[model samples]
Every structure is written in structure tokens, then in C-alpha cells.
Target chain A: MPAELLDGTKTANEILGKIRSQVAVRVAGGGSKPTLATVLVGADPASITYTRMKRKRCESVGMRSLKVELPAETTTEQLLAEIEKLGNDPGVHGILLQHPCPPHIDERAAFEAIPTAKDVDGVTLGSFADMWFGLGGFDSCTPGGIMRLLRAYDLPLSGKRAVVIGRSAILGKPMAGLLLAADATVTICHSRTPDVAAAVREADVVVAAVGRAEFVKGDWIKPGAVVADAGYNAGNVGDVEHAAAAERAAWITPVPGGVGPMTIATLLEQTLVAAERDA
Target chain B: MPAELLDGTKTANEILGKIRSQVAVRVAGGGSKPTLATVLVGADPASITYTRMKRKRCESVGMRSLKVELPAETTTEQLLAEIEKLGNDPGVHGILLQHPCPPHIDERAAFEAIPTAKDVDGVTLGSFADMWFGLGGFDSCTPGGIMRLLRAYDLPLSGKRAVVIGRSAILGKPMAGLLLAADATVTICHSRTPDVAAAVREADVVVAAVGRAEFVKGDWIKPGAVVADAGYNAGNVGDVEHAAAAERAAWITPVPGGVGPMTIATLLEQTLVAAERDA
Candidate 1:
């Protein structure tokens, strides 16, 4: 039998429904609605679209969105100043700096400016440490969403062998940390990794976050393994070869409606959490 | 032929010599000497010995030591207040909080209170993230010592498979991060790991940080691999069966004069760096 689709869109909708109801209860209790501040540093079309989708998601859940748009030529110092302003703003319960700020800008420096209290995007170093140590801090959206998806499917992670392909700070690295915290034996494979196929073959859970089109081949997956493809490549392609992988894997995520929708949903959910904590 | 020993005593003495000269230069240049403040919450005998060794090491290198001793009944808030004082004190360049601070006190909270600027012990969440991301920051002492050992021996790590048998924040987790940053494929195993021996068998580099005597068997080590035993179990036994491992491994660290001395050396080096930054 082919793999059961993880159905991220359905899971995302369910989450959003819960978030909407929670927002209603808070508002009915005379609590101020949660607010998410998003800063976009460049005019990259994909980034623009992502920021718009995130803003739209915030509005759909009855949360306020504060969008700060900057030109492509913005300096790193200017970007840091803007983020610092949002971090200090009393109205901003959560802060999100859209990734892939223009070249020549120190992205890490910008992310560090967002204080842990309001770092809903979970991009700061403090949040990363907390996530890795299982200390209940906010996690990066896509990895956090993947965990939620795994929990929703009732997939047992403890004592499982997990292979995380890619080591990007936002996705791959934290994904491994989360899996490790879940008691999974995690092996992080990157471009320099000598035997990616061998590693994936031994994995009970394979997380592909390499941002390449169908980079993880079907044959590499173990039969009945859970495959989470977090990459959103240029042509709507996921990191895993979906149809082929489905033939062998027991469960797999689809590209467009899978991890992508969940990322935005997690962002909104974490923003609600930050707001609640602030309240 | 048996594996060559990685001499931590010689390396530490060399480092101390360099630090002494550096301190002399800084003092002659009219810069203030570095100061490390150690906070011991309880009167645990082992903790007292460790703190004393750290302080003596600081003084031997021409650094000032500020010792803060508290009773076993000290509350978490009281400890946090003490750490806050040290963090804010301009004279303090580094802060070290001896671990195992009574069962009732929240140790993580106390460690978090030490500001990142003075966290030469590298116990803070910020330092962990910085170490993992390869952003030049203070590293946890034991792991930093292990890294220095690896570098001193000119052991090439790129494309190597390293299995770290423990997940303690200070030793195993940060050790894996340091190795990963050096381009090694890293796997972290802990008590919950189903097959520790199997993981060790596949590793080109095995770092045993689990606090158990001879926990990592000699047969598990791959022949000609590099073995770093970080455990300091009672009776001077290491996590790896050192003699047996040395017979098979190409390079190995002996228990007494190995990783232990390097820890103090790194703490002193990081304190010097912190002081220089402050100056």
C-alpha cells in the first residue's frame, strides 16, 4: 500500500481553528488581542509572499499584525535598530524577522536583537538553546510544526533512529535537537556527510530540510519509515521524491499543503503563546 | 604497538605559561587583571575541592579570584541575587557556579542569571547557541578542553563519524557541537540510547562523557580510532576501558592527566579572553 499522507493542510486548519477559539476566549475576557510584528528587509518576491501569508494568517486568527517593510539596500545596523524598536514596543507581543535578509547584512546579529520574551519566531540564540535543552522555549516554526505533525499522527519517536538531512540553523539543526530531546537517536547529515543514503536507509524517521528538489531519493528510505519533507523548492518540489518515497514509506508529507501551511500556523500559535505569557 | 597518549598535563602547563606571559603584557600595558568569581551554594566536599582548584588555577595565572560561599539551605532566588551581583560588578570578568547546588535549588535558573559577557564557564544558553553556531563565544570548559586536545594532537575531524556517549550540557552536547562545527558527522547518545555499543562501534571518534566507569567497552571502539574519555568516575576510572581501548585505538587520553587538567586550563583561558573583551 502507498504511504498515508500526513495531510499538513488539514492539521494546520485544525490548529488554526483552536487558535481562533482561544483568541475569542481571551478577547471575551477583556484581554487585549495578541499582536505579531513582522520585519521584511528586502523585496525578494518569495519573502514578500511569505510575509503576506503570515500577516494574513494573523488576521484570520483575529490577531493584530504590525508589518515593517524595508528597502533592499538596508544596512545591517539599520535592520538591527528596527528590530530593537519592535522588541521594545509595548504593543508587540511577538516579533518575526522574515528570513533571507539581503546579502551583506549580518542576519545573526539581527536575530539576536529580538529578546527571548518576544521572540515568537524562535530565531534568537537563547531560543535555540532552550529548544535544544528541552526547556520549553519557542522553537523555529517549521521544525516546531513538524513536531506537532508527528504528535498529531501519534508517531512514536522515542528510541527511534532519525536522520536529519541538512544542518541549517532554522530547520535541520533544531530538528535534530528536537528529535534528540524526544529520545530519538539522531544523526545529522549535510553536504559534507560521506554517506547520506546509508544514513537514511538506517533511519526510522527521515527529515529532509535540504532545500533541494527531490534530493532524498526513494530507495534511501527504509520501508514503513516516517518521512517529513520540509523543503519548499522553487517549483513546488519537496526535498523528498514524494511519489516514489510514498511507495516505500508508511507516512509522508506532501509539498504544497504539507509543511508550508504548518509553518505559518505554528507562527501564529507561538505568537498567541507569547501574548498569553505577556498577559 | 599501543596508541599514543594525549598528554593533557603537558598541554595545560603550556597553556598556563602562555596565559601568564599574556597577563604580564596586559598588566604592563596598564590593563586591569582578569577576575573570576566562583559561587558555591552548598558545602559538598567534591564541589569544594573543584572550586578550590579553579581558584588556585586563577591565582597561579595572575588572575584575581572572588569566592562566594552559601549555606545548603540557600534558596534559588538568593543564589540568583548573588549571581546578579557578580554579573553587574565591573571587577568580575568571569563567573563560575559550581554545579550540584543542593537538590532544592533551581540550578538552571542560577546559571542563567550570569550575564553572557561574564559567562566564562560557558554555562549560559547564549554560549551554547554561540558554540553550536560556530560564532566565536566562550565554550563550556570540559568540551573546550577536549577541542583543544583534539587540535593539539592535529587530529583531522572533517568527514569523520564521532559518537558522543552522553548529553550533559557542559560536556557531551557541546562536544558534539564543536565536533560538528569542525565538519565531523556527530551523533549524541545518552542513557536512553538503545544501543550505545553499536553507536561506538561505528564512530571514527568516540567521546565518552557518561559518568560511568568503563561504560564504553574496548571491543566497541573501531580499531585505529581516536578515543577521548571524559568521565572521571570514582577510583580514577574513565568511561572507556582505557587500557583495553588504548590497545586498539590509534590515540587515547589517560584518565588522571587527560581531560581533567584541560578543563581548568580552558576556564582560565576563557577568563582571560573575557577580561580582554571587558578592557
Candidate 2:
């Protein structure tokens, strides 16, 4: 039997649907609109596209979006100052610093400048720490989306063996943390892992977050496993070889719709949450 | 052949010897002796013994140890205020809030109260974030101690499969992060992990940190695996069944001398580092 699709597109829409209604309700009660301030550094085409999609999500949800575009030559200090200013802005409930800022900039320093309260994009170490320790802070968008997708389909995680491919701060690491918090025994594999296929075979739940297209071999996925492909490469492909994985997986998320839409949805949802908490 | 003992006691003594000489050198050069402020909330017998050992280490190393013993009924606000005062103290180089505060207190809030610069014990989320992201910050003492031990023995960690058998914030979680940072394929298994023995069998290295006596069975250890037993239970027992494991293992840390002494040594080491940085 073909695996059931996790359907991140429909799931994300449902979440945004609730967020949209809540935004209207809050505004009707004379509350301010939830706002997300996205700071785009440099001319990274992918970053530009991601930021645009996020802004569109904000508009569709009846929330406000603020775009702070900076040149490729922006200094780390300048980026930090801009983020701190957004943190102080009363209208900005959430702050998003598009990733892979110019190589010269101290990206970590810039991420740290976003105040914990306004860190809806979950790039700050404070957010990571909160998530890792279950201390209650906004989660990184893609991992947060994956968790929501897992829950929507009622997948059991407690006591399950989960394998997370990649260890990037925003994706693999946080995804592992969330799964650990959910009581799933998590194995983190990366470039240094000598036997990625063997590790994948043991996972009841597999998350492919490494950006390489078709990096996870289909034959490695265990039958009846749940697969969430968070990787969206240049060719609209994911990290996993989808066609083969889907045949073995009990549930599989499609490449374009699996992780992408949910990322923006989680960003918007967390933005509203930050605004409500502030209010 | 029985496994060679990792010999943490000897390792810790060597580290302390170096720290002792450095303290004398710094003081001779007109630098103030490094001071560690230990805020002991409630008189847990174990905590008292632990703090006393730490103070002894401080004295042996020509450092200052200030013990702030608070009442069992101390409010979280009071503890926070006291910690803040210590953070502001020029004499205090590092701060360690002894764990397991009385049930009434918000322990996380208290841990957060310690400034990042003085968080030598590494309880704060800031420290966790820094460690996870590979940015510079103090590591949790036990994990730091474990890392030092690994390096002392010249254990090769990169590209190895390691399983950590606990998820406590200070020990298992931080240890996993450190191993991940060192390029190890890491699996974190806890009480909720189904089939922990199976997980243990496949590891090139196993870290037992669940704080249960003999929780990790001997037969589960793979031949030639390096095992670090971090759990110290009552009756001088460790989390791993040592006798059986040693018979098949390549290297293992003993219960009484392993993980215990090195923890304090790492604390002393981080305190000195913090003082030097502050100076």
C-alpha cells in the first residue's frame, strides 16, 4: 500500500486559518495587529524569496509585516543595531533575520541581538536553549512545523527511535531536541556519520533536514517508518529520495508541500503568539 | 582481558595540580585569587557534602570560596536577588547555584539569575546555547569533566557511534552536545527509551548517566566499546554494571573515582578561567 501523505500544505493552511480568525478577533476587540519584522541582509536570492513568502503569509493572515532591507556590505554591528531596534519597536512582535547573512558578518552576534521576547523566528541561542531544555520559547520555524505535522497526524513519539539527519542550529539540532522532549530516543547523524544508511534503518521516525537533494537513500528507510523531509533543494527535491521512501514509509511528507509552507505558517503563528503575550 | 580503567581520580589530581600552580603564579603577579560563590538553597545533605568538597578544592588551589547558605523556605525572588548581588560583586569570579532547590523555588529562574560570565556550573540556558552552537562559553561541569577525561586518554571521537543513557540538563544533554560538536554520531536514550539494551549494543561508546544503580547491563556493552559511567548512586554503585562490562570493554571509568572527582576539577578549572577572563 502507498504511504499516507503527511500533507503539510493542508495542515499549514489549517493552522493559518485559525491564526487568521484569531487575528481578526483580536483586532475586532481593539487589539493591535500582530507584526513580524524581517531583516534581509545581502542579495541572497533564496533568502529574498523566503522573506517575500513570509511577508505574504502575514498579509493573508491579517497581520502586519515589516521588511528591513540592508545592503550586502552591512556590518555585523549595523545588523545587530537594526535587530535591536526592531526588538524595541512596539509594532514589531516578532523578529526574523534571514539566515546565511554575508559570510563576513558575525551571524551569531546578529541573531543574539534579537530580544528573547521578539525572537519568534527562534534563531537566538536563548530560543534554542529554551527549546532544548523545554523552558518555553518560540521554536525555529522548520522544526516547529515538523512537530506540528507529526502531531496533526497523531504519530506516536514516546519511546520511539527517531533519526535526525544534519545538526544545523535551526533545523537538525532543534528537531532532535523537540523529539527528545517528546520522549523519542533521537540519534543525530551528519556529515561525520560513517554509516548513515544503517542509522536510518533503525529509526521509527526519520527527518531529512540536510539540504542535499536525495541525500537519504530510499532503501535505508525502514518499513512502517514516518518520514518528514524538511529539505527543499534547487530542483524542488528534498533530502530523501521520495519515491522509494514513500513506498516503505508508513507516512511521508511531500517535498514542496511538506516542510516549506509549514515553516512560514509556524513563523506567523509564533508571531501572533508573541503579540498576544506582549498584549 | 578486563578493560583499562579511565582513572578519573588521577586525571583530576593532575588537572588540580596544574590549577594550583597557576593560582600561585597569578597571585604572585599581583592578581586577586579567583573566588567561586556557591549559593546553597536548603540543606540537602548531599549538597552540603558536595559544597564542602568544592570549598576544599578551592582552598587547595589558593582560590576563595564563599558559601551562601539560604533557608529551605527561601523564596525564588530572594535567591535571585542574592545571586544578582553576587554577580555584581567584584570579588566573585564564578557562581554555582547548587542543584535541587527546595520545591517552593523556581529553580530555572534561579539558575537564569546567574550572569553568563559567572555561570561556571553551566546551568543557564545561555551557556547551553553557546555550547550547542559551538560558540565559547562555560560547559556544564560534569560534561566538561567528561570531555577532559576523553582527551586525556586520547580517545578518538570523530565519526564514532556513541550512546548517552540519560537526558538530564547538566549531564546527558550537554554531554550529547559536546560529542556532537566533536563530530560523533550521538544517540540520547533515557528512561522512556524502549529497548535501551538494544541501543547500547550497537555503540562504539556508551555513557551511562541515568543515576540508577546498574541500570545499564554488562552484556549490552559491545566488545571494544569505551564506557563512561556518570551515574553515582547509593552504595558506591554506578549506572553501569561494571564487572560484566569491564570484561568485554576496551576502556571504562570506575564508579567512585570516575566522573565524581573530575566534576569538581572541571568546576575549579572553569572558575579560574572565568576569573582570568574577568581580570
User: What is candidate 2's TM-score for chain B alone?
Assistant: 0.99
Q: DockQ for the candidate 1 complex? A: 0.76
Model 2, A153-263: lDDT tens digits are: 999999999999999989999999999999999999999999999999999999998989999988999999999999988889999999999989999999889988888
Q: Look at candidate 2 and tell me the lDDT of residue B58.
A: 88
Give, for candidate 2 chain A, the lowest lDDT window spanning 10 residues. Answer: A127-136
Report the lDDT tens digits of candidate 2 across residue range B1-279. 999999999999999999999999999999999999988988999999989889988889899999999999999999999999999999999999998899899999999999999999988888988888788899999988988999999999999999999999999999999999999999999989989999999999899999999999999999999999998999999999999999999999999999889999999999999999998
DockQ (C-alpha) of model 2? Answer: 0.95
Candidate 1 C-alpha lDDT tens digits along B130-222: 898998889999999998998999999998888889988888888878888998888888888888888788899999999999999998989
Q: How close is every model to the real structure, measured as TM-score?
A: 0.97, 0.99
Instruction: Give the poorly placed runs of model 1, Cα more than 4 Å off.
Output: none
DockQ of each: 0.76, 0.95
Which residue pairs show backbone clashes in model 2?
none
lDDT of 1 by residue, A140-215 (tens): 9999999999999999999888889999999988888899999988888888889889889988999999988999
As for candidate 1, its interface RMSD to one decimal place is 0.8
